[model samples]
Target: MNLFTDIRTLVIASLDAMVADGALPDGLDFANVAVEPPRDAAHGDMATNAAMVLAKPAKQKPRDIAEKLAEKLAMDDRITSAEVAGPGFLNLRLAPGIWQDVIGSVLAAGTDFGRSDVGQGKKVNVEYVSANPTGPLHVGHTRGAVFGDALASLLDFAGFNVTREYYINDGGAQVDVLARSVYLRYLEAHGQEVAFEDGTYPGDYLIAVGEDLKTRVGDAYVGQPESVWLEKIRDYATEAMMDLIRADLASLGVVMDKFYSEKSLYGTGRIEAALDSLESKGLIYEGVLEPPKGKKPEDWEPREQTLFKSTEHGDDVDRPVKKSDGAWTYFAPDIAYHYDKVTRGYDLLIDIFGADHGGYVKRMKAAVSALSDGTVPLDIKLTQLVKLFKNGEPFKMSKRAGTFVTLRDVVDQVGPDVTRFVMLTRKNDAPLDFDFDKVLEQSKDNPVFYVQYANARVCSALRKATEVGLDVSDAATAAADLSLITDPAQLSVAKKLAEWPRLIEIAARTNEPHRVAFYLYELASDLHGLYHLGKDNADLRFIDEGNSAATQAKMALARAVSVVISAGLGILGVTPVEEMR
Candidate 1:
């Protein structure tokens, strides 16, 4: 069903044929040869760099290779014309029946049309939105959550065994602050006034947790000092906040496969084990790092510390694992965590971090590389911040969170589907401006609405066809005489549909789900363009009034578009609206 792959297979076979005939060298490497859509659609259906890539290796000119390869491809029934374009690129025009076959395949495959096996069932762990359990998830976490969830889905669609995870930062000083903050709320629930200091969380979202704690142990911990109740309340507060976080993620249609606790790495030999793994390889040592790279030496002081030789693995400099005071640095627990992931036998590890953690990527990768002995690869994707606007003005803070907009604020406002789509409109590494007013508009400018409207419009056409007593089942539509769909506009949509399987492999390989959003937008644009053209040209209409057979053929194309749209939106965690409100 992957037309591009099929054609590429043919192109490779042609190159091998040349090798066998001694027309080209015997030992030629064709790994880099690729058959993809031509940059200019007017050129041909596909363009291959086979001739150019094999030219220097085969000791043959590119044009000579392409001209020879073109004749070989021309013998295939699928290729209508294999022309030598430019120097060595072979532009291939596929037979029209191939495009028609793509539509029938889409209708037959339903939402599974573009599913791929590029991942080969490799085990992968995607860790994201590891926000501290201090409050509700904020705007930044919202973007990470959507991006991570969609990425997990994309990897799954591409045949990766994916585990969605969240790392809790409950072992840090932040959770102690959370415990103190909740104590104030607990006092307030007991009819005593309380004030939130600079270090405490002042959000009103914890009021319920406070009241519930009061109901559980009424006045028991009221008179206790910090030592007596700190540990107990810290556990209680972290668990409560995690529950709140789970609710927020559920509202956004996100659910993690596992929740890892950073505290578990403490009071245990896990940190030592992770370090020992590196030390055994001569990668860990005690040393004083050079002072700040660009700073004056007079302003810097060097202290001997236990450090990991991260520079050997690709980091810019060696990183500290334990400080001079014999206390583990923040990087130690992270190292232990990744070591655990490696020992668990995952083939790949992916961490989705906020843009603010950009500097941490190199060290994390080096740690994993050392721990896994270069057997497992790690990819860290940093999701940039989201700037929210309302009616063209910058969005304000949330009262519930008391400082930033919470995930609930967005899910409650736009609903989960629109919020997820808008979050993915931009690449995860690029800053996104989410205008509440703009995303909700029923216009082409709003990708969320535009894509949904195309699906709903297709449903309307199907319903109207059904009212005329015409069979609109998928089987009937797929079995229609698709050759009747000869219009350039109708065929343009089929061409886009044919690109689905190819797009899946590319997007999955890049780990960029934004490409799915972009493709869906383009497909929607093509569908909408054809629908509008029908207004001026009667032949372009989806449902011909006089002939049921013609209408069915066109409906096959429309339904095929919807099938792919639904699949793309589903991969994006979006629900296609059946009818526009």
Candidate 2:
């Protein structure tokens, strides 16, 4: 069903025939041989570097090899012509029927048209948006959440067994601050005036949690020491904050398969067990780290500590696992968490972190490498900051979140579909500017609107065809005689559709779901371009008057475009619009 793949197979077969005929030498690896669209449409429909790649290896001239290969490929029915270009590149013009078949394949497969088995069912764990359970998620976490969720969906479509996960940072000092903040709110709920100190959270969102604590215990911890209420309130506040975070994610259509608690690693021997595994490999040691670079010897203190030989596994330096106070360092729990994931038997691990955590990437990867003995690979993607603009100026902070804009703030303004689509409009590592006025504009500059408008246009065509009594069911459109779909404008759309399967494989392999959004925009452009051409040429219109056969043939192409758009948007976790208001 993949036209490029089908053509590549033919190209490879033709090369094998050349070897048999003594036109080329044997044992030339074809791994580097690639068939893709020509850089210029004026050159040809597709281009292949097979001749150029094999010429030096086979001890033959590139042009000579290309001439022989072209003759061999000309014998195939699918390739209309193959011509040598430049030194050894071969440009090919496919038979028009080949493009027509791509349309039929799209309709036949429906939304599963571009689904690939490139992943081969490997188990993949994607951990993202592991923000501290202190309050509702912020704009930075929103980007990570959308990126991770979309990546999980893309992997699933590419045939990977994906698990969406969230690692809760509950067993940290931050949670204790949250508990104290809630305690202050609890006093206020008990008719006592309280002041939120600089270290405590002052967001209005915690007001309800404080009131709820009053209802549950009726001020049992009132006027008591921190020892009596700190632990209990820490647990209670974490649960409440997590509930708020879940609702925020739900607003954006994200649901995790697992929520791992960092607290579970403590008091459960898991941290010790993970370190023990490392110790058995001679990677653990008691040593003093060198003074950090740029520090004077007099200003630096050398303390003996328990360290992990992280540099052996690609880190910049050895990392300390335990502090001088005989307590676990911050990196200890993270190492244990990854060790736990490796023992769970996942083939791959992907972590989506905010841009500020870029320094943590190497150490985390080293930990997983040491834990899994380099058997499981870890890929960490860092999502950069999102700058919001409204009314031609930088958007202000949310009052409810106190310091930043919440995820719900963005979603409530533009709704989930626009929010999700706009977040992915840029690469994960590149900073993004989310302009409220621009994204909502119904114009070509707006990718979300452009893509959605294309889908809506297809739906409008389908409804018009139905009114005219043309049968446009899936089976009927798939079985329509596509030979009449020979117009240059229509064939261009089919050519774009042929790239869907290849696009999925590439995006999944690179772990970049933003490429899907980019591809959808290009496909939508092609669809819209063809739709605009039909205004002047009646023959190019989707519905031909008084000719059922011609109308079905044209409508089939329009329907096929919608099928691919739906599939692409489905991977992005955005619902396709039937009509754009």
Candidate 3:
């Protein structure tokens, strides 16, 4: 059903025919031969670089090869013309019937139109939004959460066995701080005035947790020593904070398949086992790291430490597994966690991290490479900062979060669909400006609104047709005489729909879900363009008065557009609107 792929297959077949007819040499490796949309639409509908890529290997001039290839391709019923453009590129114009059939194909496939099997059922682990389980998730974590969740969906649509995961940072010292902070709140709940010191959390969200702790254990652990209450409170606070985070993610429609606790790696021999695996490969050593690049000699302290030869696996330098104090370093648990994932038999691993963790990428990759013995590949994507603007000024911090806006703050302002779509309007590594006033504006400039409006408009058309007693069911529309949909504007939309399958494959291969949002915007534009054209020309309208056959033909195209939009938004974790308010 992929028009582009079908056309490419024809192009390859024609090249093979040329080799047989002695128009070109054999063994010309068509791996690099690509059939894609031409740079200028005025040139043709599609372009191929087969002649240009095979010229040197075929021992023939590119223009000569293109002329013969064009003749061979012209014999096919699908291609209307194949003209040789500048030097070697062969620009192709498909038959109008082919574009019309694309609409029928979309109706036949429904939301499954663009789903691909490029991933081939490979097991993929996508770990994202692994924020510290100390408080509700903030804005930075929101972007990572949305990105990771959408990526998992995209991979699933592309036929990967995806596992959405969250790695809890509960085992770190940060949890100890959270416990002490909750202890202060617990004292306040016991009618004792407490001061939140600089190192402790002061958010009002913890007030409820403190009151809940009092309800669970009345007068127990009251005025107790740190030794008696710290451990118990740490576990309780971590669970409460994780509950808050889970609710926050639910508001935005992000659900993880697994929540991995970093604490599980400790006291479990998992860290030692991971390191032992590395040691067996001669990657572990006892060595002193060189002084940091900018550190002065007098300020530097040299000590023998247990290190991983990360440099051998693409890291900038060797990394320490244990500190001078003989305790595991911060990276030790991360190594163990990834090693655990590697042993889980996943074929691919993807980590979505905040932009600040860019420096951690190489070392983590090196760890996975060493642990998997270069078998499993790791892809790390960093989501950049989100700047919020309201009333044409910088948005204020959330009082509930104390230092930043929470994910719930954004989701509450605009519902989950708008929040999810607007967040992905920009590339992951590029900084995004989330303007409260702009994204909700019902205008073309707002991408989420534009795309949603297109689907809504299609729904309106379908409803009007049904009211007029025209059968617009999927089966009926798909069975319409699509050849009657020959208007230029209608064909334009069909052409864009043809790109969906190809675009999904490209976005999945590059691990970029933002491309799906971008493609949806373009498709929406084409749908809108066709809608506008119907105003002046009654023949171009989706519902032709008194002509059921013509109305069904055009309504089929409109319905097909909605199908693709729903599929694209589904991958983005956004619900398509039947009607935009």
Candidate 4:
């Protein structure tokens, strides 16, 4: 059903025929030959660089090879004409029946129209939104969460065995701060006044956790020192905050396949084992790290520390794993954590980190590389910040979350669908300005609304067809005589639909979910254009009073648009609206 792929196959077949006739050199690698849409739609349906790519390798001029290739390709029934454009680019015009058949294929496939098998079911691990278990998730975490979830879904749809994971940051000093903060709230629950000092969390969200602790075990640690209660309260507080984090993710319709606790790696053999694996590979050693050339060095002498030879694995320099004091550095657990992932035998690993973690990318990749002996590849995608606005004004931060807008706050205002869609409207590495006033508006400027409106319009067409006593079921529409859908406007939308499977493969190969959003918006624009054309021309309308076959053909095309829209929205984790409000 991929017209581009089918056309590329024809192009390759014609090139083989040229080689068979001695018109082109044999053994020329044509793997780089590509058939894609022309830069300008007015040029042709597809443009291929086969001649341009093969010219130098075949020791022939591009124009000469292009002329012969065009002649060979014009023999196919599917390709109406092939013309040589500037220095050997071949632009191809497809037969009208091909576009008509694309609509039929979409109807037959339904919501699974664009699903791809490009991933080949390879095992992939995607870890994202590993926010600290100290409080609610904020705006930046929401972007990563939405991006990560969509990416996992995209890979799954692309035939990858994807596992969605969240790493809990409960092993750090921040959790200690959370524990003490909860102790303060616990004391307040005992009818005693306690002030939140400089290191304690003062958010109102923790008030309930403290009250819950009071309800669980009252009067047990009221007057005790830090020794007897610290560990107990730390575990208790970590669990409570994880519950809060899980709830926040649930509100956004994001579900994780695994929640890996950083604390579980602590005092466990996992850290020692990961370091042991490196040591066995001669990657671990005791050394001193030098500072950058331009930066002023610290007023201290070199000290022996356990380090990993990350420089050999593409990092800028070797990194420390253990300090002089014999304590594991922050990098130690991270190495061990990723080693655990590698040991589980994943073909690929992807981390969705905030833009602030850009420095961690190279070192983390080096760790995974050294851990897997350069077999498993790791990709770290950093999501940029989100600046929230409403009515041309900056949105205020939530007092409950202290400094930034919480994920719950954004989801509650706009709902999960709008929040997820707007979050992906930009590239993951670029800053996004999410305007509440603009996103919720019913105008075409709101991409989410526009895409949803296209689906609703299709449903409206289906309802009208059914009202006229025509069978609007999927089976009926798929079997409709599609040659009746010969209008240029209707065929234009079908051409766009034909690009869906190709776009899915492109998005999956690049590991970019935002491309799906961009493609859906473009497809919706084409659908809207065709629907508007039906308004002025009665013959272009989906329903015809006398001919059920013609009406079914037109309605079939409309439903195919909705089918692709639903598939795209499914990957985005956004609910498709059958009727826009």
TM-score of each model, paired residue for residue: 0.98, 0.98, 0.98, 0.98
Can you write out model 2's per-residue Cα lDDT over 269-351, one digit (the tens) per residue?
99999999999999999999998778568866889999999999999999999998999999999999999999999999999
Taking the tens digit of each residue's C-alpha lDDT, what string does model 1 give over 1-581?
89899999998899899888888988788899999989998998899999999999888899999999999999999999989988889999988889999998988888999899989999999999999999999999999999999999999999899999999998889999999999889989999988999779899998998899899999888868999788989999999999999999999999999999999999999999999999999999989998877756786678999999999999999999999999999999999999999999999999999999999999999999999989999999999999999977999999989888999998888999999999999999999998888889999999999999999999999999888887877778978998898887888889999999999999999999999999999999999999999999988888776888888898999999899999999999999988999
Lowest-sum lDDT 10-residue window in model 1: 292-301
RMSD per candidate (Å) reads: 1.2, 1.3, 1.2, 1.3
lDDT of the candidates, in the order given: 0.93, 0.94, 0.93, 0.92
TM-score of predicted structure 4: 0.98
Global lDDT of model 4: 0.92
Angstrom error of the Cα, residue 406, model 1: value is 0.7
Candidate 4 residue-wise lDDT, 339-426, digit = tens: 9999998999999999999999999999999999999999999999999998799999999987779999999899999999999999
Q: Specify the poorest-scoring 10-residue window by lDDT in model 3.
A: 292-301
Q: Could you arrange the candidates by lDDT from highest to lowest?
A: 2, 3, 1, 4
Q: Candidate 1: which stretches are off by over 4 Å?
A: 296-300
